[model samples]
Target: METFLKLFENPSVLKFTKLGLWILLIVLIIGFLRKLLKKRIEDTSVRYKAQKGVEIIGYFLIILMIFMAITLDDIKDYTIIIGLFTAGITFTLQELILSIAGSFYIFFVRVYKPGDRIEINNIKGDVIDIDSIYTTLMEMGEWVSSDNYSGRIVKISNAFVFKGPIKNYSMDFPFVWDELNILVTYDSDITLAKDLILAEANELLSEYSQKSKTKWQEMVERYYIENATIEPTIAVNLTDNWIALNLRYITDYKLRRDTRNKLFSNIEKTIRSTKGKVTLASTTLQLLKIPELEVQLKNKL
Candidate 1:
């Protein structure tokens, strides 16, 4: 008890204790503010962003307080030491520094926000969080097909923004052009198949097609973009086996698989109604030669 009392009596110890108290107070205040923010903000993305901003500010304040407490007497005398230390830290944490810079770049350049589906480094997912070091994604399309979630969370380094391309699915326009293909026999009525595909796509995706057209027009006006076919259109590719009728149309990214199922089902019904006019194609196996096999007698006999 005497030793503890003496330690507290020392001026340097007292100063450090005061600084520690101040740091604790700051931490508590920031925590309270974050709790208040959580209650006030409803949007997950916005709430997270605000919380991060508050945390950064709190860290800066804590660091500033520490710096001021240590350098109260002679900050100029420590300048060279500080410079050298900063340089060493910069060299040691080069990747970390780059990631921080990339975080700033992502925020300022409006690269993709939380809730946006993005693909970077060939990794496709929906952005869930953006922190100082990493961008967290709810992964999709690994073992799954057509933008379906794969039940995996992926954390990518923010520094990757400098190294690769990022494809955002819902930044300016919230629609994507998707293609569905059906193979029809070479002898089938190619024109009727095309017409049937176009008819089904137009009927099913008419709302999305019209909305995407307006969005594309807005994009054209805002950016230097060319006019595109936003409506449901059909293109035919002649293959060795069959003619591929490709139905291209705009759709909400989230509703792609559902839309495709509806379109395919509807088109199959429509084609079936056409009887033998537009027959679906399949691979035909033509045997050039047959191998002979001999039967063996049973051992039990």
Candidate 2:
């Protein structure tokens, strides 16, 4: 390594060292700000936001320092070479670049921040951490299905932010409007069927809706947002052989399955009370013509 030794003997190495010192100073400043911010802030969210700002600034400083180090003396002459080298890397390390860019996009757009439950591409879970190239999720869809965390860890590339359908569960409008469609035979009393579905949804979802509404209203006031009319409603549609009873309501994204369980149990119990009167629609085949023909032939004989 005579070449390596010779490189350090030059003045450019000293310049690189100076830039490193500058970066180290920036780190100390960021650390000081964090300590200062911690003393006055009680909100975890605010502390996290402050920490994130520090981290982003540190990244920029480090990158800039490295770039400055590359621009000294003999190294300064190789700027074009570095450009070409970076271009080559862009083509070869496409996924890495896309992932990095994706992270930036997610951060700036505030698509789904940390602690938000999300379904990205098909994996559903709460976002636990956001790194430069990947987002870590507390894995879901195992024991408790339907977008709830199942106590596992998953790391997905940030590139998925651009390529896949992203579902955010902790947004301003975090509650989701969900429904359970129950169809009954035509012989069922239409009014009774409708009442059953509506009563089940209301009994189970009423408390949650009220609590969510109050919380959302407080958030709206704090954030100075426009008030929205938030109410849960059920609907009914009909066909010849069946009546479609849809129990629609807003629910916590992670608890859609739980809500469904309550709604289904109530609906099942009510429908059971009307046994034989209200039953699920099923396929039926009738041979009326053959029976009538057989009776006529016997009569004629």
Candidate 3:
């Protein structure tokens, strides 16, 4: 029993003992903070500012602990030993280091912060929080129709920002251009139909186009972005079944579902009011009598 106690008293062992104790203390403190963290963050929307506080505090604690361990004369040699370990850590855990770098990029670059909806790769969601190892997302737009949530939580490595295209839906010039295709009968009066559809789209899209244009111009002045033409219009494609009118126009990104519904409803109404100038296209069935039908009639006679 005395030998075991003496072994633990060794300086090298003591350094490890202190590190474990400090890490354990950090875990407990973090656990307690986690309980109150959600409620506190909900009251304020400055997630970036709040997370900056967390990052600073967490790193401070880690550094202090490391400093204390290094102060031990018995363990000063181990500090040199740790340098050798760093190269191995850098190689083996390179992905994790990149994730940490990504976290810093997210903070300093002011990219998509918590609560903003973003798409990294094909996964789309509202970002719930940014943790040390992974970013949390309220997973959406998979298995569910439209852009609705699947009621699942996803944690993606932050390094994905560099690996794939980062789509920030709520960033500067947050509106998106959604297209709906409507087909009217080919024989329909193309001019009148175009006018009615154009009228509906202009009324529906003009407001958002103006808003997006103003916002985009502000961004252009702040950054070197190419000038954009802020107009909402429809393009027509003539096809066998109908004249395909693609309503390509700007709309609030999050309100895509609602915008689509309004566009479709008004289109239906416009078609009705057009005095038979337009009709929704559909295939008609035509049947001809078979050779057997005439022979059967003659036989009956």
Candidate 4:
């Protein structure tokens, strides 16, 4: 232990030892603070911000300690050299710098945060985490349909925000307008079909209709947009084979698939209970013209 102490007594060795000790102290302090943060902060978003702020402060302190360990004369002599080295590093790591800048832009602009369902550059997901370089996502809507998670975690570079438009599903308005079409034979009761479909929609989507109006009013006030109907509506169109009743309604962004399933099931049951008054339409081919067929058989000898 005496030999080790003697080795650290050298001026250069002593300076580095102090720097290392300070860095270790910072790490321990940061760890303790993080534990306290976890215990004290219950709100997830607030906790995340505080934890990240502490981490950045810890890094800054470590860098400050390293700079202080260097002699003043060395800094004076190598100032220009350090400037040139930094310039080179900046050029080499320009993409990383842009990514950090993009992260700052995201935070400042409130582009999207953790828990926002967003789509950008053809990738769609619910954001799980956002860091300086990347936005982590619980990926959705690739092979799976209707906003279902694909069981993949995607890490997209934050710099991609600068590249394209982003669609946010759960931001100001957490509800979306979805349309479901029901086709009935031309001879079926179009009025009853529309009434049944509209009734089912009203039943399934009443909550969204009531809640989304206030949220949409906020959006209209914030953006340049006109008032949109939130209540369930039915529009009928006549086609060659069938009469189509398009049922449009508002629903929570995440509940679209389940809501649709329930609405369709209810509508089908209602329509079937009508007992052929509302017959669902299917494409049928009619044999308008048939080619002449000739058959010749030889008599058995």
For each candidate, what is the lDDT?
A: 0.88, 0.79, 0.80, 0.87
Superior by lDDT: candidate 1 or candidate 4: 1
Cα lDDT tens digits, model 1, 1-301, are 9999999997767877999999999899889999999999999878898988887687678879978877785558668877898899889999998988788789879898889999998999999988878999999987888778999999999999999899998999999888888989988998888888888888888899778888888999999978998888888898899999888888998898899899999999999999899999999998786778999988885
- All candidates in order of lDDT, best leading: 1, 4, 3, 2
Query: Candidate 2 — what's its lDDT?
Result: 0.79
lDDT of 4 by residue, 80-181 (tens): 877897799889998897887788788779899889999987899999988878999999988987779999999999899999999999999998889888
Mark the regions of model 3 whose C-alpha exceeds 4 Å error after superposition.
4-27, 30-52, 63-80, 91-94, 293-301
How far out, in Å, is residue 241 in model 4? 2.0
Q: Write the per-residue lDDT of candidate 3 for residues 207-256, one digit (tens) a residue.
A: 88889989988988999889876666678898776789887778888889
Using lDDT as the yardstick, the better of models 1 and 2 is 1
Q: What TM-score would each prediction reach against the true structure?
A: 0.80, 0.69, 0.81, 0.78
TM value for model 4: 0.78
Sort by TM-score, top down from the best: 3, 1, 4, 2
Candidate 3 versus truth, CA RMSD in Å, comes to 4.1
User: 3 or 4: which has the higher TM-score?
Assistant: 3
Report clash pairs, candidate 4. none
Best by lDDT: 1
Candidate 1 lDDT at 1 equals 97
For model 1, name the residue pairs that clash: none
Index of the highest-TM-score prediction: 3
Clashing pairs in 2: none
